[model samples]
Target: MLPSPLAAAAPPLPPQSSDEDFFSTASTSTSSDSKPRSPPPTLPQIPIVWPEAGALTASWVADLMQAFEWASKALPPSEFPSVLPVAVFDKLVLTASKILHKEPNCVRIDENSELNSDCRVVVVGDVHGQLHDVLFLLRDAGFPADDRFFVFNGDYVDRGAWGLEVFLLLLAWKVLMPHRVFLLRGNHESKYCTSVYGFEKEVLVKYGDNGKHVYRKCLGCFEGLPLASIIAGQVYTAHGGLFRGTIITPSKRSKKKNRKVVHNPKVDSLILGSFEELAKARRSVLDPPWEGQNLIPGDILWSDPSMTPGLSPNIERGIGLLYGPDCTEEFLKKFNLKLIIRSHEGPDARDKRPDLGGMNVGYTIDHIVESGKLITLFSAPDYPQFQATEERYKNKGAYIVLEPPNFDTPMFHSFEAVTPRPKVNPYYDFEDVIDSDEELDLVSMVTDSGLQQPAV
Candidate 1:
């Protein structure tokens, strides 16, 4: 249950629906005229559970899982009911927004981030819309139990056909176990990116205006999400790799002697802003100064790491800074941290490289052995890109089960993509799919696929 203050501010609940109601045809909530209607008569209940405080019972979660699986299997995922209905999503947006408002622009966390000697945490990265995989992680991996705590490293939406399913399910679980789940912002969780990516378009096509509204509200929640998390106060976690608050040096020598390259040294590279400072870095930040803007709102959301010696512009991505092992080491020492756990890049491959995966891999650790510093965690395995037809060994994904933060040994779980995902079209380009209605779909296709630290 939420604290008294937060509970008091909760949004009004819509009238209850039966077990069969969610999958039933949606009501005309999207009548161009925005008229408020009276509440529906309360039903006895579905097999689903909606206990007090929005806390879900185990039965409810199981039902929700079955609901999503049934929906995806019933029709082509790109169709109308492939995703959650308009009214349901609309209610969810409101609830999610209220919860987000309770959180500060930058959330502060000190206690929960710390893992006791016996406690273990599961750090996840970049599910990227693999709904079946997420189900596997929860059911197969056994998450969301009262005892387990989770720190999701973002990149939750986009790239997969089931992005909405993945996101809403995670959000539902967050509401279920608010204190045990932690969500960090990823590079993809913004307006500009989602607009270009398939998330925005998918909603518009599936749920229409209500979906658009829910997408907007989701962005608001994204804006309010914390940029970085301090784990056990010893590890710093974020989506992108690293950042510097300010420039300290002006120039640097290149590989050739006397050949100077332009380099702006950071004043304090390792010091992530306190919760108050992080809270201020919100949705407004789109690109970095190097790309266009002078002030990037959250560096942790955009930055990447390099193999060289110091911090440098990430010309390849056209934004954010790239740090080398030396740079990572300095940042860790500067902040008095032992490790920097990050996502943003894929674990098996550099950029979701198809056919570049293998078994027994879920995360990549860099700088830890050489510099006692960074570990990169990419949770999406066998990232099935639309054009990826080639068969390869590197199609497995991985995650880390951290044991009490005692010298950073995490148990690894790796698996390949399950069957039942769309085969012809990539997730980002789903909107472009034209009629070949007779065309064989993944239906015949056969593809497959949260903790909290602080609010205010």
Candidate 2:
């Protein structure tokens, strides 16, 4: 049975759209020989209603999910979907981006409010496409409501064959229930990652010539996604783990004494970054190169916690920091938080870093410090959806339910991947996929794609 949250204080449902027509069907054409060609695939759509006209019905959203699932399973790789009259996709993306842009880098969800008294907040990890599993997850955890909120810790696209479907569905929910659904930006959300990962290729395959426009809109939406979220003043959630504290490092100096030259560098003093700093940080960069003081957004979206003490660079990923337990304790104590929940690793990363557990169960309490616990959650089961016989991780997916009043302890729900997922080919070449720590030659990637270099 699906788990139920405390009684929800859901607001009155909005009036449904009046129009009965919803499906935007594809047309099949015939050759002069009279042999019918296969019908081109089409994106999922509901009654095209303006935001002011009325909110989309729950039934409409449900239908959209079903439509996406069906298409992913039935459509062939050679056939690209028609996304013309692109306004339909544009409307949802632009509207959701506007809402997300206005949100602070760290969105705060306070507890003890009239609406949150009995409600619960569901925290989900990376869902790199995998639409069928997402559908199963929603059904398992219950949909977002006024009381039951959802904080999706990024990585919504890439890897799986149905990223476009997964992303659009989440955006639809965000537009319909903005307050209840908080979508944080994962490192994969950036342009560089998408260009290297399968998302960009997936969009091009799914939308044909109009794919560029749709992909551009997705980049805009990615820039608007928040970096982190604070739940009920107790839990801290980000796609990656801890962010770096402000620091002042002295420059190197040389001193000559007794005809000998000596070079000395002053030690660096660290000051943990505050919520105020996080709120003030600029996070709208389409792609953060993780350079200079501008690295706050990178840190938030890419950093990971370590067993060692204090903060150091996340050398493994080539960006962000590998903050130790001391860092976690200090950050939690300073902010009065009880736990840190983040998601980015999968079975692949786990194999390399076993200190964080096998990830076979999908969630790991990486660090249990005196101040609180730092948990790592991965919601995509059997991650890296298309894998060779030797590459399968066979891991379960999981989500966390945080109950209110205190909202400290997290109830973990783990599930296996949906069976018989649509058989589809990977859009990207296997050689293009690289290790997490490796950097892609972006200029070459863009040049090969016949597109100009994106602005740094």
Candidate 3:
């Protein structure tokens, strides 16, 4: 059996508390508008055995799939269902965090490894807690094995009913096969984002009294997750696209009354950070403060590729930078890489770009510079699982499969949402989950600090 990093404990029965008690004011509670809900059926006691490396065979995965199926079919809980034992959950998170903590901010999957040289790599995008969908994706994409590798580009939790289940299952796989499976950090993985979104509430409802401890453990695991991965030394993959270097210069502008002395950063003056720099990044920070040296981690997790021509601060998100075609080319050319694969946007961001076929396709090539292409992949279909009928995007989800040898060319596999997902009550008010960073008001932070946003 794999060594347990934490002692297993029985899951304590949670004290009766309304869902509102867990979430912040920013999130509208689902309990407020809906009819009075019943407490979830208690899960019967099941003997828990921590996974052994040898025991983590296909049957182990199948058992996990079966347990998740039960959890998915059950009604949404006002509190955690305790499907995963507290001890098992603790040991899983602690073990996974320990493994992740040893990895650098940027993980390299090179072709030099004899074992991986002929393996196929499947790169998955954001899976925002859609357990059923993830299961389908795994079945469709084929499970990770000695000859088939998997790279999940973060955003494992939040937005859906099964975030914790989805996250833990992936953690099991990570512990089972660390070299073949890579988990990169997504913007939603942060403590701040989970608190603002539904993950914190999901954990609380799922784990009850132990929810706080589970959630804290989740944050620790998030801290340990690597920021990005380089596949075959040719493709760069991250949840967010690109980042700016350590250099940030205050622009010289004449003082004029009423005209804000913006810290206009010169596009040329900004540097696209190197993999060496990415390796040196302090990714353990739970929520990077998005200023000074902290900007690198925040940018790596939050930045988006722009159709524009230069790198500039992502004003809309209030964190990370919006990089353009030129920036993509620069980054790729500098690293001698071929493509950039990232995932953070969903239908909302996809539909805005009608030219890119909108939400019809799961992946989009946002920028095609001379060096290579910058692709955006979103794997959560009909995203934001619980939404008003009129607002649904009805989008398909996708994953990219790269063959052995070069691993440069990407083959896209897009699939529609699984039919008839188990009916679960919404956790957070749909209206309250705004995508922009304005909720944090970090733009005001820029002005307050007297740093004018550099013109693109």
Candidate 4:
């Protein structure tokens, strides 16, 4: 059976106290329809605050101040940059504002579904819409129609100019084999990133207003995606790392009993819904106030892969955040899992360094590390165009294959395989090269069978 939807819903709180109201009295005033009302008077623009010398060069400072001034005068108050405190450096504020504009604070993933017993799995790294590379990897890995299940591990769009095409192909494949194929939400799947990075605008450019239809379809796919999955009772796979306040417990009752859980109360209420419920809970904890201390185990869905081991000292006490290995052992002991397979980190990470020697593999962009207890994989072989370098491998592209456990052999088979390329050099004509009648006949026999004859 396909996974079910999460039961969490926005709560209907009692009427708010007067101070808590979001709608102001001014906003409620309705002008008479008989005559159109005049536009409201513009407020005085705030002067640009310049940074002190040594902090920012005069030219750089002037340019930013000019830009801010221009924006203040041209844009509406709601669109203006928030005023920074005098004590904060103007240059810092300007830099931060630019970063914020590029990378939105919040990301949204729509939803997705998958069959329950499709246990054997292989998750591809980020595709970034590299059509040839994606197809090559799938073909080489024996995917799409293989008995083994597959997860795209988020990042199906953006970076590559071909996000739409890539997503459409995946959508078609999903329809063909809904039970075996799954797409999970990635940080790049957000509206903020899509708006700036080209996926959203690309669709608009390609489909016009109908572009929104495409966007909605993609968002729906994202929203319905399972945040993470446990396969063959041993692995947990998602786009990113675990959130700060998350704790993994054996039972749903324990998750509820934990007082530190501060995500949407609705999510806590729906703990028993399905694996998708765990995903919704992850979204809430990883939202705004991300730096806030109350994260829970479900929050791991949104956490970024970190090189640092052990609990972050900056994190609050009493919250049960554990290393990937600790998490692996705990899950193994409690749920009878033999290992933990995760894909947030790259498959080629420097050393198999999970805090507790857990198997981990990092297989995509940046680095890929494959350890015994934890493994990181990436489906997008190329680095995102907007970001750093692409992943390096002897093979043209990559994917993983998992088999049932055996006492004589390890539980999983994970590695990169090199693909031979066609020879580019011209063949040589040598007088002594198999000129005998028997040898010539043998060459002719090989060529007749569609095999390449030895170069002469």
List clash counts for every candidate, in order: 30, 0, 7, 50
For each candidate in the order shown, give its overall lDDT on alpha carbons: 0.55, 0.72, 0.72, 0.39
Error of 2 at 271 (Å): 4.1
For candidate 2, what is the total of clashing residue pairs?
A: 0
TM-score for each candidate, following the candidate numbering: 0.70, 0.81, 0.81, 0.48
Judge candidate 1 at residue 323 and give its lDDT: 76
**What tens digits encode model 1's per-residue C-alpha lDDT throughout 423-451?**
32444654464211112121211221011
**1 or 4: which has the higher TM-score?**
1
Candidate 1: where are CA atoms >4 Å away? 1-55, 78-83, 104-115, 247-280, 283-298, 347-360, 369-371, 392-394, 405-407, 420-427, 430-456
Off by over 4 Å in 4: 1-120, 243-298, 305-308, 313-328, 345-372, 385-397, 405-456
Candidate 3 all-Cα RMSD = 10.6
Candidate 3 similarity to native, TM-score: 0.81
Output the TM-score of candidate 2. 0.81
What local lDDT score does residue 104 receive in model 3, on the 0 to 100 scale?
Answer: 82
Model 2 worst lDDT window (10 residues) = 21-30
Tell me how far the alpha carbon of residue 177 in candidate 2 is from the true structure, in angstroms, after superposition.
Answer: 0.6
Span of 10 residues, lowest total lDDT, candidate 4: 22-31
**CA displacement after TM-score superposition, residue 349 of candidate 3 (Å):** 1.9
Candidate 4, residues 144-259, lDDT tens digits: the string is 44345666766677655456556655554454455566665565565544553467765655455455665665554444444555555455555554443333344555745654
